[model samples]
Target: MFEKSYDVAVCGGGIAGAAAAIASARQGKKTVFIEKTVMSGGLATTGLIYIYLPLCDGYGTQVLFGIAEELLLASLKYGPGNIPNWRIGKNAEEAKRYRIIFSPASFTLAIDELLVNAGVDIWYDTLICGAQVENGRLTAVEVENKSGRGRINAKCFVDATGDADVAHFAGLDCPTAQNALAFWVLEHAKGAKWRLEGSIESVSMHADGGSIDKKRGMSGIDGAEVTKFILDGRAKYLARLKKEYASGNQSRTTLFPLTLPSMAQFRTTRHIPALYKLRDGEDWKHFDDSIGMTADWRKSGFVWEIPYRSMVPVGLKNLVAAGRCTAAEEDAWEVTRVIPTAALTGEAAGTAAALCADKGISPDELPVTVLQDALRKAGNKIHLEDVGLAPKK
Candidate 1:
């Protein structure tokens, strides 16, 4: 019904886009965030990817803080005695595992409040179909809603559209790699007649609850059992889910079938050629631009630097990318797919876009130091020790 623009535009009202919009609005820039679905939290809400994932490094430091920390702490408050841990990493010297978990509904409300309080404009159930470009830079983007099609012009744009929808439409070469895939999920529950004692399992899915079926869906089966299974059996279930995904049929309403998100979720689609791409190499064993980090189940450890270049596409002066759509190898999707890391990058991208507006410069030439400081001031973690960019020992 309304057709207007702002200083900055971020597509994809998911965690990343929301963080970027909030960061920009907080800095006094008029910003707009767009989402194809309602209930702004993206994967966290609509997709049901409840776990925020990889919030900190191994040193017990939250490499990705700022709005990321704010959202998690707020969500964790609902769980009385059983909140997921937020401490990962040992110190600033080495990368550690991430310890972050959040509820879907809690995450949605928390960030929705952040955006509202900060005064970032957001549109839901909208899809960006194209972009309005000048000689090279994008001047405005074309979007479509249920009513009709329209346009939004902005000083700069952050393509947080997850699948790089905006950037690709703007003539940016967004190559969809075949290495990964994505899906949205909805989980239902059924028979709650399962128990785990002190031996192999200490938690019980059926202990104090009814069954996890339509018969028992109405019973007071909170999210505790889901968290327990994810934390303790992520590796196990991950494999099982992958193996049985095609054949695993129990009713989406059944407890066993309702195990994952409303539908299964996917973040990346394999190799993308941004100005920078996270290559599969050992030199990155210890990254230099490490802004945030994540560890995979205390096994093969990885801490990634949120690179300034990743946010800004190389050739597109006005366009930037964020969230699971950013540059990453297929295998690395697990790390960046998390909400906090994605939101941190979203924060960075938003900051960069606003910087372009303030300095009247291209996103490529926007002051990195200034953007870094703004992000740092906003409470995002940037690894200073890894400044040398050395391989890990």
Candidate 2:
């Protein structure tokens, strides 16, 4: 097998993996980012999931900062969106929980640019087929690509594969969940301009179509099931297009699909069992190892501090989970699995990875205080007390 080494290896090129790689490389680590798809911005771009969720606590303050905020604004750099000028109080109400709608294509370009400028060695079109762990420490990841089976060795690794692919491959005990079947496609409306659908509409689809209830235990872990899910979603969308054509809806005819999501938009698949699992109603709870803070996107005043323990897998020593695959119960999963949370956790995991590599220690052994200090200096609000936010009334 082909072999290479890096200071930090980040699996998956979604927002989390991208953020993690950028963070590590910016800290002067030799970082490598691997993604199965050819393009960057996994779900946000390839999946046509256009919403960049909020970066603030919903009441009247901005909570998440650092890479989370940087990526949110970068998403708008080449697309249509708004970011209120909090300094001058211009559209300050909108700044309370700043969110934006960005073009998937533009986001892909932006993320690629960020990675290149960060000096990250990105390997696109690579899939992590297996992983190697010796004495509870991740040593290398086995990947398959045009080069065939290869090994990527790193001092520290970040499992940002969204489904915890690296953790699962390393024979770790991980929790798995199935997602409801949902598909999103980008279509061009000749005369229509893009608009933000507000908090509620951002998550809902206004397209004319029906859904196929998920089959029992049809998690995407199986290749056959994944194939079926994609084909079924595509067929449904095609049928809608045909129906519109037959109805003589001239406007609908101009609305051609811009691109289909290259990856299935499954919200959750597998997650590592970490030292701590963020649970429901734990909002506003303080963690001594809190690395960053995130707010519940669906509602108004609940805030959660992400513990460093949650990113540290239970049995792994040199690896950390940075995406939705992070440890969280069903309800808390909704909060941590979004775009903003992915970037926040990714930055933490990458930063921690770099520190661990630099100091020659495992992620769990690295002092949380040191990591927190670095994050705070990087513009992150690490605690509820710092943000002055609390559970909703």
* 7-48 per-residue lDDT for model 1 (tens digits): 999988887898889888988999988887777777677666
TM-score of predicted structure 1: 0.74
Per-residue lDDT tens digits of candidate 2, residues 236-301? 777877776787763454756757778987888988899999998888788889989887877766
Backbone clashes (count) for model 2: 0
Error of 2 at 306 (Å): 1.1
Q: In model 2, what are the clashing residue pairs, if there are any?
A: none
Top lDDT: which candidate number?
2
What C-alpha lDDT does candidate 1 achieve relative to the native structure?
Answer: 0.62
Question: How do all models score by TM-score?
Answer: 0.74, 0.90
